[model samples]
Target chain A: MWEIARSNKRKSVIFVFLMALLLVLMGGVFGEHFAQSAETGLLVAFVIWVILSIIAYFQGRNVFLAVSGAHKIRKEDHPRLFNIVEEMTIASLLPAIPEIYIIDDPAPNAFAVGRKPDSAAVAVTSGLLNTLNRDELQGVIAHEIGHIINRDTLFMSMLGVMLGSIVILSEIARRSLFFGGGRRRTRTSSSGGGQIQVILMIAGLVLMLLAPILARLIYLAASRKREYLADASAAIFTRLPEGLASALEKISVSPIRLRKINQVTAPMYTINPLQNMKLAEDSLFSTHPSTLNRVRILRSMAGGSGYDAYDAAFRAVTGQTRAIIPPSALKTAHATVPSRSRRSDPKSDPGTDQTKQAPSAMGMAGAVLTAAVLMDAAAEPVTPAAKVRETTDAIWKSRGYRFIPCPCGAALKVPPDYRRTDIVCLRCGRKHPAASAS
Target chain B: MECPVCRESMIVIEYDDIELDYCVGCMGVWFDAGEIELMLGKSGIPFPSEALRFRVADTDARELRRPCPLCGKTMQKVCPEHGRVILDRCPAGEGIWFDAGEIREVIKESAGAAGDIVLGALRRYLGEALAEK
Candidate 1:
């Protein structure tokens, strides 16, 4: 994992240099041909880069979050989410817990952003919180933290800002040329040197059209790699490949669309937030790798929750292992194969894994019981047991357990274990069928 | 925004830039004008692009009529996605009101290629646990 992070850092540096060179060349050509000053073109490009860099450095996360309609949330606003994030942070040994936010949109999606781990923020959609259970949510959160730990968010957001600027600049250039703003210069430049200059100008124009596309391809390629590395980190941190694998399945399969996602920031999400945009799995322009392929790689990791096991699974699933998880990382990885069946009644269900620990009602109860016992032993009641139970219930309700609103104005929660088809509302004694509540 | 039915102050909830008027007392939501469309956009399902459109005839089954919260004018009955999901829209086109969990139902049942894919993937990946039945 360290090796992967190092390589990512190295590649990021190279990409930055490449982007700068492209900008300088394009700007120099535009100045020399149109403005009659290479200095002017270079200055314009430099200024654009500087401005975009400042924006990305200071407010990139905010811009993306705002665009996605995410609002900052306190721990009290969502204790279950806070708890899961806290767990992932502790497990990863992150210096500080990332600020949490929730988008009101029903799309089951999540992303992390910040230049550094301590400053990072993780945001998940309301739909995601509703759809995924505890383990699945943890898997997704761990993956986001992986991006933070690997320092991928900075590079990814920087690339987004740069690539977006290039696209905008290209659009402006194309429009100016299309409207004949350069026709006067072309007509006057009839000298031999002028012809060479004109040719260079045309070449530059062609490059302008192609540069953004090329930049995007490079960005997507890098984005895909970062995703795989994050997955590996998530599994390594949680020691539960199936948790994230199932989560990947749920997220990808969710048709809920993000209201404000675009090509630039799409790569930052756990799964491509815009996967519903109809891009092919292996399309050169796709932001993330095929979620199906990702799920397969995760599912194949039967050995252990180590980099080596993940590498083996990735190799078995993708047939080429050279690009992701490096050899050095595998050497340090442990050899304990993870238990695939961690819960009872595995064979009866083929679709969703009903592992007792994966956020089911029963599992939630078990967690509460364990926490209560630990708190009792500690003799320090930071959060009252009743408070913990209420929060747990709130989490379940958020995940779509039926809440019965009685005439007495109190909302009665229908417990998941109630076997009777009809039951009286505990608060108002109103009889209602169980099926109607859902 | 206030709830038309309960006449209670509604909480202003933000989903992206789209703000919803949510009634705490009744657990209802009001989407002003294009707010529902904005929320629907997040679902990534394309707006109706076909030449021929299908509409479900209004049955007026919901007898409890609530006036428009924005204008206090009587609202029209609207079944946005077939007749299964009924909502009240202002006659003046101001907004629509939905009780709590109706949006979830709309999202869950909306038929589209993307929705089908996710549902199929869920079944394949999680099996019986995903099927509520």
Candidate 2:
């Protein structure tokens, strides 16, 4: 895990430097075009890059939180969520519990921010709190905490600010191009310096046009790798990879899109909120890996939810012998094989995990049927947050409960203490016949 | 904002930055048009086309119709196609009114897409027989 953080830091430092260089070049072009001097342009661009980096380093997280409409929440507002976050903080062994904030939008998403774990903040949408059960919510929080522990939040914020500048600079340059940039400065008719100036202008123009795209591609690549590491960390923290796998499945398939998230902040989210745009899951432009692929890897873990198990599952599913986790980390890793092992079971093999998890022909037909039912139901939530919480106990029991639909549309909620064979509906005074399981 | 249902003065409850008006008597909440749009917008998801318009020419609506507290016009009864909750939207684009428990239903419906995603995958991969087992 430390190796993952080290590698991410190394990659991010390189990425940030490249972005800084791009910013300087953009600044130089703008300065040279306006001031008509090569040396002055480079100096001005360098200054601009430094100023922007300083601003991003100091206040980027605040700007990001404000832009996302995140506001701090007292523990009283949502005690359950607060407690879960507290639990994750301890599990991740952070020095201090990060502050929590909530975004009122119904989209289920969460992200961590700030320069370090001690100063970090985690924000979740109201929709996330309402949708996920306690265990699933814990899983999500653990994932965010993983990002904090791995120092991905600081790197992500820095990248966002730099990329933001690139986009802004490009926009300004594009406008200048359209507006003719205050009339091209006329120079001496036959000079080698003038020829160099023209070449520089063309080069700057080309860089300005391509910088945003380049930054975005690099940002996506960096973000996807961090997401995998965060997932691994989350598994280790929760010691229940299935929980996060289920949460991801829910988040990816969610219909409600986050309202405040844009391209700049999209990579910070647990699942890319823009994914509903229906880009190919495996496309390079995607900020996160395919949700199905992530879930498959998590579920395929044979025993302990450790980094090694995740790394092994990752390789097995990806069909690559190369390890995702660093070799240095693997040396000290715990190897846990499930106690109830079946060597002859083909389905249990890592090599065939994907094949076993892949959708069957009948399942495709079933999905179509499910989609139709969903469309008819519209986007209405089938279960309330409170009710979902009730089912969370099923995770431990490994048993399902049957709901007896009452005439008044409310289900007869059989409490754990209910001893009668017939459960009374609270909404309408109707008595429904139910199994006396409670 | 006063509750259209009970006409009682509403108390403001702050959830993050969103200040929602909740009626003390009826517990119905009033959300301004801008607030609704802001919430919908920030969620980074597109709003359903049907919910955008405040007033429609066809006025015959469901029985739960109530006057908009701000405009005094009979609010249109809107049942989101995907939701079982019936929300009262103002004709003048002022705001929408949600009865006490309606919002919970709407939230649950908002989760349907995710539910489908999880259930769909499980059904497709495991098959009904194995899934049941």
Candidate 3:
């Protein structure tokens, strides 16, 4: 179980206080109506708020799915993708099958959200499929399952809906008042309903403006701690830290970054979705712990046989044991993954080849190792980052660039960056910028 | 198309005319970095929004990574996120590598973002035309 940090707990308390403030402000506005009329309007208002919020809880998934335009998929359209999800779900033993959605995108990414596994959803971009091999793909899928099983999906979605409601309602209030919510107040108070009513109406308008901020405070309170819990759960679900490490590395390298994803919904993913912070700078406002930090934690786990390593990894990444996966049961739990596809695409036929070994493009381990051993750690991420005098330029020099997918099963193929002006792919007939300069 | 990983000869069996140069051997693609955008053209992404950049992330903020897979030199990194999706941009501006199923993910993630990008661009284009009028 993930422990809630004192800092976060205090934040939650503050959020509840803000909520209480919003309600109290509302009560003040209507207090007058009930004071004069013996109708129990305050009781009625409170009931209505409770009823609507409850309804929202049950139906929140539908709204999120629809708004995000996530479409459901069967194992048929994408058997490999679907099977990986199934394996992860069974390994995690989640109560209900989370809805799987596919978005037509070129970016390598995936996310989980909804009220519960029963109402949970897992969405992935088409690009993720193209980028990862079976093992790497399985790692990402299991990570998503970790989110569902831990109920982080539900937590984040609930928070997103709550925040959405605040924004939508405040916008409505602003519009209605402009058209006239105050019109009724003016008419109702005409007979002598003087200063107090005007003051109350003003108060209501001000509350309307503050509602979205209050909603966010609630989300921030609810989010940060839950992230620590999910990370631990992910590590438990997928024994090999290398798989996730590789997945993150691939995601990090892909040109299409996930910018549309936001704070309210980001916690539902296996990794933090914030794009602004550099990996090194992530200890501060990032909801998901930094990838390197998580990798370090996992690497520590790989090295140690005892509980101390686990403790150290958890504490270092999460700052404390808000959530934990015990060594005993966690070890026994069989985290599952889809078996590799043995099918051979003639182009990347791995067999009958020698000399040039296919770039295993496995985890960042290859990169990390190369960095740790061959080059300084400081220069490692730099090679993958850009302009490293590596093989990227050599391929272009011999022949005009071609848009060929590598043997890795990654669907995209790029040309050299130096010759970036305009490219004519002899094979694909598509003209593109050299190495995606756009 | 060339292989993105090892940049060798490749053949794309999926989709019509979208013969990506993937190393039939290594399973990587040669995106030519900018080639991905040329392939996606106008109809990219999920539901009315830009996706590629918004889907994956690299906080290191290095645009330098964009480069030719074959040359082993840095190519320009474009977000491939489609417009403001804004991931690492390839300055060399050619080709992209969609590791296997990334094409599907790119389209799926871009659903909303693509729609938004298309509409916005069309609106701006038409607005510019009207202004000229």
Best by TM-score: 1
- Who wins the lDDT comparison? 1
Writing each residue's lDDT as its tens digit, candidate 3 over B1-133 gives 4443444445432222233354434334444444444444533422332444433444554433544555544544344444323332233444455443444444434655444454344232122211211
Worst lDDT 10-window in candidate 1 chain B = B48-57
Worst 10 residues of 2 chain A by lDDT: A367-376
Model 2 CA deviation exceeding 4 Å by range: A180-182, A188-198, A277-279, A333-438, B1-9, B12-133
Alpha-carbon TM-score of each model against the true structure: 0.66, 0.63, 0.49
Error of 1 at A276 (Å): 4.4
Identify the CAPRI category of the predicted complex in candidate 1: incorrect
The runs of at least 3 residues in candidate 3 whose Cα sits more than 4 Å from the true structure, single-residue gaps closed, are: A1-58, A95-99, A114-120, A172-209, A258-267, A271-274, A278-296, A302-311, A317-438, B1-133
* Count of clashing residue pairs in every prediction: 10, 20, 171
Name model 1 segments beyond 4 Å from true: A1-3, A276-280, A321-323, A333-407, A411-438, B2-8, B11-88, B91-133
Q: Residue A244 of model 1: what lDDT?
A: 91
State the number of backbone clashes in model 2: 20
Poorest lDDT segment (10 consecutive residues) of candidate 1 chain A: A368-377
Model 1 lDDT, residue A66, Cα: 84
Can you write out model 2's per-residue Cα lDDT over A326-421, one digit (the tens) per residue? Answer: 665555432231211122333444333323333464343222111011111212234683433322322212212233544444433333333345
Best first by DockQ, ranked: 1, 2, 3
